[model samples]
Target chain A: MKKLLIALLVSTFSFSAMADGHAEWWKKAGAPYAGTVIQGVAENTPPGQFAGEVLAKDFEKLTGIKVQLENTSWDQMYDKAIKDMEANSGIYDFVYIEQDIVYSYLDRDFLVNITQSLKDQPELVAPMVNMDDFTTFIDYFKDGSGDVFGMPMEAFVKVYLYRKDLFGAADAKSGFQKKYGYPLAPATSFAQWRDNAEFFTGYCAEKGMECWGTTVQGHTGHPASTYEFLESIGPSFGLYNWGVTDDFHSCVEGGGSLNGARAKAALTFWTSMLEFAPPESLQSTWSEVASTFAAGRAAQGWVYGENAAWIASNEEKSVVVGNVGVMQPPTAPGVMTQAAAGEGYIGYFDGGAYGIPHSSKNKEATLLWLQYIAQSEVQADWAVAGARITHYSTYDDPKVAAMDQIADGYFTLMQNTGYLYAGAPMYPFHAAGRAAIDPFTYAALAGEMSPSDALDGACEALDKVMKDLGYQN
Target chain B: MNSSKTAWLLLSPTIVILIIVGLLPFLYVLYVGFFNWMPLGKNKEMEFINFGYNYRELVFDKFFIDSVWRSIRFAIVTLALELTLGFLLALSLLSSFPLKAFFRSVHTLPLVIAPIVVGAIFKLFLVQGLGPIPFLAKELFGFKLNYMSSEAQAFWTIVVMDVWHWTPFVTLTLLAGLSALPQDPYESAKIDGANNFQIFIYITIPMLVPVLIVVIFIRMMDSLKIVDEVWMLTAGGPGYSTRFTGIHIWKEVFEKRTYGYGSAMSVLYLYITIVICWILYSVMVSRGKANEDE
Candidate 1:
């Protein structure tokens, strides 16, 4: 009887605590729109843990709509989004999707179509959200036909995160030019970038200093980071600049095969430089990469812009936060490839976009949620507080502008330089292709197979896939 | 009539479960295997292709053939290792020892943990650079051992992890078989002054053959269809060094979105598993019949 009482007391207290956590969003309306919204985000940050408080208090006070945010890790959020959408689980009212999986949702029509949804909820979209600012963003998704699919929320981006102290140690300016006939500044092309990283990291490693020059994400399964790294280096080679001539009617899709000399050469240049990365990079998974970079192990980590927020929060790991450099990714040593005239990589595919599922019964409410988030005010606030990349006409808020990291005009640099690769959307089934590449490609590099043989083997396997799907002409 | 009614009622749930969970899905996979399919129905161009194309490609594709070979190799390697380790463990465990019950329960720990869990733990321990196993290798042995990064090492590491997880299964089964052995032959051998090794080889060996054959058969059948561990640990990676048929088929199902193609690959995989298992079963059964006649 005594034991039962103790157990009962514990259960009651825990249950009430959970209820308070969940129901805190159900506050009395002091504003026009006074309902609670269930928002889901990845567990990487604290917003989700303190969801009932942070989002609810600010959101309700500002918009009169109470937001109930549930946080799970970024990886869990990606998996859950798929399951919830496929099964029409609706467990989450508004899920926070990792930017990488946005394409999966876009391809499957599992997310809310914010472009259309914004029309219905003017109160949500009113003076705060600027439609005019999203012209570039809209035209990015608009193919020949002017249909828009997604509204950008947050972006995980690559900045040439280098060490200033290293720069400080060396004869910073004139010494670099004398050593390598180039100006000592942020690398504008892929070739110079590679050479610099190799020079520093490789040279350091040889000296038995335990420190290498450069690092980035290259986990066996973390393809997203790998793709990002490849793209950063790709542009300097003019790789992403070329598309299979947009005249699809005249040409076969993916006409520019990965097996092409240019692609292989680009990959070779990329792979050969692995000597500069940490030995443990092969096992450094996504979180490990972030923490490693935060731990400041590598001299330069291919880092995301949002890492600024993370660096700010975690004091123990980051030694030089204000001194940390932020800019567009470096070019490969010899990649002079420019985007065919207008075929620029304006939007790299790494931002969250809303999509409406066919299974959704409450499309209106869902649309309202989408429009509300896409508003300029929200986008600006997301940048300042959420520390997220805004898709709304670039936020002009002084709060975001004051960020010393972005003060070097990195956003502007990327805005001007970045390209939207006309690559196939990263759908779920791309997993097979991803799975196939690692073992065979690495083997090729390791002298098991020639590059041509690797391509042939991989292509033949893919051909079988095509044939299995009856995709032969 | 009442007895018959009771039997039918008692057996109905199993029958229903078999249909719902097993037979129907198995048959459906076979049906889906006959055509081209997409998950979201967007690729109208790829909609109606026949199964003939799939068969032709599978027959021709070297990667598919290689993947099949890998899966078969994996199963054979794991089975041999499991039986050897398990048999030895069974011998030791058959006798009473300190903490016998606790140790026996510990032997089944891997069995209780999910295959995915085993994969995760091993991945953490075996992953190149970050894993502790490599640290131990470098510090203690002074070897540049990459259990996962290198192709051959990746395959061997997976095999070793599997052996660790599954050998206990064989041991527990073999222990049970050893425990069930009759004492008459041992008693006669003891009276005749037959030594331990000689008596064991002549008496315990032939008697436990049937149970061992059955155990081998069961383990072989399950090992061939293993997807979760291979997928979780490596996803057949370090450049397809670990790419098994299980990884191939699952990729088709989840990543490729070609449900029909995935179904077809699964059907082909299933066919191979069944044929191999059937051959083993036939040998075991015929051996049993021969023993019975003897």
Candidate 2:
């Protein structure tokens, strides 16, 4: 009898605690949709792992709806989700909408109009959850009519991460200075970046260190290498939107700037720097680049901010923990000014959102699940765990702010210098366009083709693909 | 029930399954092939063009043609190596040995592994810096080796990985055939004072032809549709040097959402596989007749 009484008291207290803050509204509004099992799929990244392990459980407890989040590999997730939707299989209630893929998904009408769904069912919208609270990254998932189709779960910009220890060492810095005849520091321009690449590589080689000046995401056999060139490196040199103009013209022919002098120059510069990179650079993906940098194999590289926190702080995986620094990527001369005029972005802003699929049977339940994730109280923990934050106010969370010292002020750079970054171009033929141009970019990296020839071939192919897709004549 | 009616009832389940799972999908593909089918989005509708547009697009698609040729190349190379190596291994194992059972079991290990798992294992083994292969090559040979960076390296790496994974399968099949062979012919050949090589050529090869035909057909069909192993390794990359027909069709159907065009590719791939099978069938028939004539 005493045990039963204690159990009752425990249950009552737990209920009251859950009903105190944003949880109260969720519990009340979600009651009608209780016991509905909703399924979601996402890539097996840090954020996906967090959602699968933590948020999925928390959501079930708060809403009485079972959430099954399957974290699949990058390609498999896209394949499964798209197949499920195409078949009208109703297999996935929610899917991870990558920022780059929004154009393709929207073009296909594969997503539910989440904004309209929220407005239609006002009670499902938690009080703390507001459309305005999210950063402009949410705009990536919005259609031209301004109706959002997904809830932004993670947002991060690609940034230049360098080894602070290497730069701080007196001998190393002086040695770099002696070679380059400039004060050795984080690069401010492309010329300095190249000089630093050469100097540090030569320095490390001369010293017999097991390191290179920089790691390269130049995997010749994969699309990732091509992505690095077009998104991170090309944009810095004023190549915007895959070097294609809005009117479907190549930059080289003075249509938009894709194969233009600056873009071609950027491509050449990007590929040429591979020489100073580690031997593994030719086969390195983004993950390998991060690992190489963390293992102290490279002095610097353009690392996706998603990897910044763990690489800078995780002691088990990162040898250079607490010894990393983040900065904006170096740009070509006058490119920064052009970027300021909104002509280009510094680097790719890479992240994904949880979207309700059109094939979902339990739309209301899924909406509640999305709203539960968007709550301000829940943002801080998820941000710290996933190294990504969607809400504008998440930066002010003490836990996130504390991570500043660890991530080398990555969070601060993202928020203050957010304008300089952009998500993938909103092309309807996003993946197809990528496929069309990737091989040429890859050929250039493999020394099979000159940068100019590669760009020209890529531009020609893009024109053909665009025309084939009914985008152009 | 009458005997005929009962027989029909027993086979009904299989027939129904065949119609639903097999015939329906093929017919659907044929039907969809006539239209410009975009399987998703606002333009998610099939527009009828009488199959002209899709076939024309496919015919002119250099990527698809290149992928087909690459797949054939991989098939021919791996098939030749596996058959040769497997035959040699089977012959060596035929004679009584001290650890014959242990050796036989070990040889069949690769057959049991999933292709995707093989791909993952090889990826860990071959990745330039992270993999031990490169580290060892650099330390022992005083030269760095990268298997996934260069176009040629990637193609050969996938080929080697496929051979390693599948050669054991061929060896085990041939071993089973050897075990099932009649001893009368071998004993007769031995009594005739025929050498081991002469016996193998005259008796064993002829007897194993039918089994060889089956094994060859299975491997040929599977190799033509290879995707998972190569995808996990190179993903038809480094400028499409290792791109296979299966991966190309997959990209079209799933990634590009070009349902009609992908169906056309699939149908074309099916026709090509069938034609190759027919040619192999004729060769097998000719070889069997030759053996019977002897």
Q: Please, what are the lDDT tens digits per residue for candidate 1 over residues A115-198?
A: 555555544343334556662534433323455455545553456666656555555445567778876555555566666666
TM-score of 1: 0.82
For candidate 2, lDDT tens digit of each residue in A1-473? 99999998998787568558666677888789889999999988777788889988988887799999999877779888888887789999999999988888888789999889888878777776766889888888888889989898888888998889888989987887777687999888888888878878887888888888777799876668888988899888878788787777664664757778887998999889888898878777777788888899888889888888888888999899988999999987777777778876878889999998889999999988888888766787777766787898899987899887678889999899888878888787888778778778778887778999999888988787676677764
Q: Which number leads on lDDT?
A: 2
- Give a tens-digit lDDT track for model 2, residues B99-169: 99998888788888888888889988877657898789889998657765577888888888888998888
How high is the lDDT of residue A155 in model 1? 53
What share of the reference contacts survives in each candidate?
0.36, 0.53
